[model samples]
Target: MRVSRAETTMNYVLLLGFAAFALAPVITILVTAVSAPLGESGGIHLGNFARAWTIGGFGRTLGNSAVVAVIVVTTATALSILAGYAFGTMHFRGATVLFYLFLLGMMIPAEATIIPLFFDLRTLGLTDTYLAIALPQVAQSIAFGTFWLRAQFRALPVSLIEAAALDGAGPLRALVQILVPASRPAIVTMVVLVFMWTWNEFLIALIMAPGGRLRTAPLGLANFQGQYTAETALLAAGAVIVALPTVILFLLLQRHFIRGMLEGVAK
Candidate 1:
């Protein structure tokens, strides 16, 4: 049935409201980054952003965030894609139990496990390193990423695999050649999700690297707040610098992302 005009109108209204709600803060942040001048400025001073960059130690924090996010996304995607393919397509005993164990990560709060992780990291002397921040994100990301990609992998016709086998192609060959190419949409979806989460992650960064030992961008932003109350412009600039990459990534990959979601939902 066609949607009623009244329903469409209501939907549009709700959509506009949501759009405004979501964008208002982003606009505020960007505007403030340029003009609000978070601290020590009589009014709006664009110089505030540069000051925040230096004083807040944004350079180090940004580098730390970059390294951690890059490592997490790469490891998470590689492991999840491989495991997802196996779990979704190949048959095996104990798979169900293992998948359930993986699901347990979802139920447990990241916060709840931080203390134990801290002790574990302390023992290994990995604390304050990019590895410490990245490993947990990888582990946390894998479960859902695996589950998501498994469905994508499974959606392919088994006949493809059978045909590849008839042609003397091994399982790995078929997966690498045929399955992976066909599943790019889903992989892009996972990439976007993981990157965004890892980029914006604050708590893990906070616990893993305090005192700007290895500050991430979010931590830098927070530290910026403490150092400058009047240089809001600088804060805004830093935030924009931090935010734009993710937004650009989303824009470039959104079509594949939508297709992946639609296909997953249909399956």
Candidate 2:
């Protein structure tokens, strides 16, 4: 008993250390955001945040980011869950090969695809539009989401699905009422992962939505830095604001994510 107690304490101590390491930079950014003035003032001020907020145009940028993240998360979650079920629970012609092909997108680096995506969007008149950013992110989400959800779906007992079918539940019905509810952890994990990815996504937003007017938070923050020029504190505040949503999302969903990864994948 003493040994077990000692082990648990040590584990917690280690976890706290890891937590600090992860949070240090985030805390630093928060500190910086409130600490200094735009230029020669070099002292703490609340105005830094306000100044960054107004000048950075973060309100519009944050709104744009919120829209994209929400849409991408919902669209990707639904599509990925459906596709994952198809690939995992219901085998169709070319399904295996197609899933692997989707997985191949993971191998191809983002840099390789950005140029082609730009040209394609330019032709389609999607440049500087939310669709321009959202569509590419949707596609990118599939690569990872499919892989993750397929694993979750594949882990379910065949008996559960078969039992539902026997009870007059159609495939769609069973998927919604049975498969999905049973796979809550996996779904939560997928949502969190998708939200975080879409929220933090920088390069695609930068390339696809270059207009300062249409910029997302990260892009807006970058531009804010240039616009303020020497206001490290304000810049840091903007950075913190941009990062907050992702942090809250991860905290909310992290438990389910880890559980799904461990237990859901095992099945």
Candidate 3:
């Protein structure tokens, strides 16, 4: 059925309205970040970012977040690819039970387990370190990645796998050389999501790295907000700094991300 011109116009209007609603706060923040702080008179205050960076110690915190994101994304994606392939293609005893166990990670809330997790990490003497922050997120990411990639793998034609096997390709070879390349969009989507979650994670970093030495970007931004409560420009700048990486990553991978999400939904 063809949509009427009035309906098309109405849809465009609704979409534009939603787009503005979503972007208004971001635009306001960007404007505030560059504007002169209250009781000051000047042009664009680019120096607020520098001041925020120094006072917030964002150099260290951003570095820490980057490290954690890398560790979580790399480890979770690799493990999830292998696990998803197994779960999607292979049949074994207890496979259903094991898959549901992985799904349990998704069912459970982080808040429910964070306190116990902290104590467990403390007992192991892993607290106040990068592993303390990265490890939990890696586990969480793997659960989600496995669920996502499994569907992607299952949606592929079985003939591809059969063809690879007929050509004397082993499972590992088939995965690395054939399936992985075919599932690039899904893999990229998982990586982007995992990186964003790991980068923005605050409670885990706050609880695990209590010493503040390994504070992630979001954690540092919270601390910066506390100290600069009256410095609106500086606070806005810090918020932007913390959010910029995820925004950049999303923009760069938006095509693959959107395609993967659509495909996943269709599958």
Candidate 4:
């Protein structure tokens, strides 16, 4: 069962190769962002970012994206924890059926439902608003969150819950004081994923908030691309601006995220 040093070294080298392959495009983009444009050669064009930010209106769009992500992540995580706890611990009639209904949200693509969703939102006068952008993503995140957190909750020992109950703790108290803390990594992983998904989402934001008043960062980046087809450095700079938040978030929470993912696999 033991691995030799040569095997371990080989594994590390293979992993490095795969990592480099994955990072190659990102490296290219970063290099292109700083590189001189097609003409008028000079030092690395750091000014491209300033120009892109101003021209793309990314300041507003980025703030909109942040607002939507916070709303979705907060609502989805809180609801998912409660749903996960109920499904994982307390069994009831129709629980399986209801859980499968939630899973159906994941099975259905946003593309499939976006048109009708837009119509529905418009009918409710919710279109072109922050709620319009945040709500659907909240629903999407909840489906996965329920699936993820339920497993984590179910993995805890039954004795732990019973012990809390014996100590006069109610269901809410037991969950808040013990289970939530214990499942912090999984919860954090879910938060990071939901934030990234909400941030990167383009289609929903495009269709739901079409007035351009509530454009998210990705939406703004798309518009920037259209206007700057000839400007590679500016395009790359806009892309970096759009992608930077998610990258920073992942870097910040990578330890917890990796632990949560490994635990999910193990479970």
Candidate 5:
């Protein structure tokens, strides 16, 4: 079958329209961030970023977010891979129930759990610490990570695992040497998503460690707004500053991310 020229032209038009529609807000944000200040004439004022940085204390807060994201993504991805492999490949009693238990973590919202988490972490003397934010996020990330990787692993060909076994390789060897390498695309996708979620997490970070040295970027931006909302250019610049890392990250790994997602859906 061949697509006619008319149909191809229509497809391109629709795609371009959708692309522009999606990109409109991002273009607006960039323009707003760089536009001349009100009542001032300039090509593109760069001072707004400087002002937002100083006012927002974005240096400290972005560092805090980086730390949390690294810890959460690393810990959660490692744990999820192990758990997903076990649940997807191994035979055991109550496995369905256990997997469902992990799924419950995904079903529950952070808002519903944040209050109790605050008290619990405070009691454990972990509140206002990086761990306070990282722990819950790790748990949350692991839930979805486990679900994602489990589905990916279950879709693997059984003959591959059986071949490894016949060669006298144990489970750990089989996983690390064979399955993990084979599942690179799926794992990269999970890492990217978990990093994005952990980086942008606001509710738990705010509730668990508000107004202290542990304030993440979003919290810092929130506080920045309260003090400097009148400066719209600076505010827009601050938003752009905080969002840049995630955008850069997604752009770098987008191919792997899309491949992983497609693999998950295929399975």
Candidate 6:
């Protein structure tokens, strides 16, 4: 069936409307962020960024966020790949039960678990540290990562595995040489997603490192906001500073991300 001109026009119009709705606030933020921060002389400039950076202590916060994101993504992806391969290919007793237990992480909300999580971390003397945020986020990322990569791995040709086995390839070699290369797009997509989630995560950061030196970017921005409630331009600048990395990451990896989604959906 062909789409009519009228329908196509309507679809374009609706898409443009949605785009505008989504982009308006972002544009507003960019405009405000670049504009002169309250009473400062001259026209739009980059000084707001400088001020926001200093005021928010973004140097340290961004470093903290980067550290957490790197650790979580690395650890979670590695674990997920192993777990995914196991669930996708290996048939063993109690696998279903264990898989379901992993799925329970997906079913539960972070808010529901955060209280106990904080207590557990505090008891372990990990609060106000990078692991406080990294571990929980890793757990969350692993749950979804396992689910996503399992589907990706499961969709691969069985012949590939059999051929690798016939060639005397160990499971580790098979995963690294055969499966990983083929699953690059899925892995990249997962990394980008997990990075975005971990970077923007606020509640966990706020609770885990409240007033601590190790606060993540989001927490730093929040603290900055409290101190500068009247400084809208500064706030906007700080937000952009905090959010720009994820935006750049998504833009860079959007193709692989979309391909991964399409493959997952198709499978």
Q: Which RMSD does model 6 reach against the true structure?
A: 1.5
The runs of at least 3 residues in candidate 6 whose Cα sits more than 4 Å from the true structure, single-residue gaps closed, are none
Writing each residue's lDDT as its tens digit, candidate 1 over 159-264 gives: 9999999999998899899998899999999999999999899988888765558888887787777766555576678787778778999999999999988888
Off by over 4 Å in 4: none
For lDDT, candidate 2 versus 6, the one ahead is: 6
- The TM-score measured for candidate 2 stands at 0.90
TM-score of each: 0.89, 0.90, 0.98, 0.97, 0.96, 0.95
Ranking the candidates on TM-score from highest down gives 3, 4, 5, 6, 2, 1
How high is the lDDT of residue 125 in model 1? 90
Native RMSD of candidate 5 (Å): 1.3
Error of 3 at 266 (Å): 1.3
Candidate 2 Cα misplacement greater than 4 A, ranges: 1-12, 36-44, 264-267
Candidate 6 C-alpha lDDT tens digits along 1-267 = 999999999999999999999999999999988887777876887888998898789999899999999999999999999999999988999999999999988999899999998988899999988888899999999999999988989999999899999999998899999999999999998999899999989888888876587888888898899999999989999999999999999999999999987887788
Which one is best on lDDT? 4
- State each candidate's clash count: 14, 1, 0, 0, 0, 0
Best by TM-score: 3
Better of 1 and 4 by TM-score: 4
Q: Which digits, one per residue and each the tens of the lDDT, describe model 5 over residues 1-267?
A: 999999999999999999999999888888888877667887898887997898789999999999999999999989999999999999999999999999999999988888988999999999889999999999999999999889888999999899999999999999999999999999999998888888888888888886578999988888888987777777789999999999999999999889888887787
Tens-digit lDDT track of model 4 for 1-267: 999999999999999999999999999999889888778686888988998899999999999999999999999999999999999999899999999999998999999999999999999999999999999999999999999999999999999899999999999999999999999999999999999999999999999998999999998999999988999999999999999999999999999999999999999
Relative to the true structure, candidate 1 reaches a TM of 0.89
Ranking by lDDT: 4, 3, 6, 5, 2, 1
Per-residue lDDT of candidate 2, residues 14-50 (tens digit): 9999999998997888788878573455566777778
Taking all chains together, the TM-score of candidate 3 against the true structure is: 0.98
Candidate 6 lDDT for residue 241? 96
Worst 10 residues of 6 by lDDT: 36-45
User: lDDT by residue for model 3 over 1-267, one digit each (tens)?
Assistant: 999999999999999999999999999999999999878897999988998999999999999999999899999999999999999988999999999999988999899999999999999999999999999998899899999988899999999999999999999999999999999999999999899888888889999999988988998899889998998899999999999999999999999999988888888
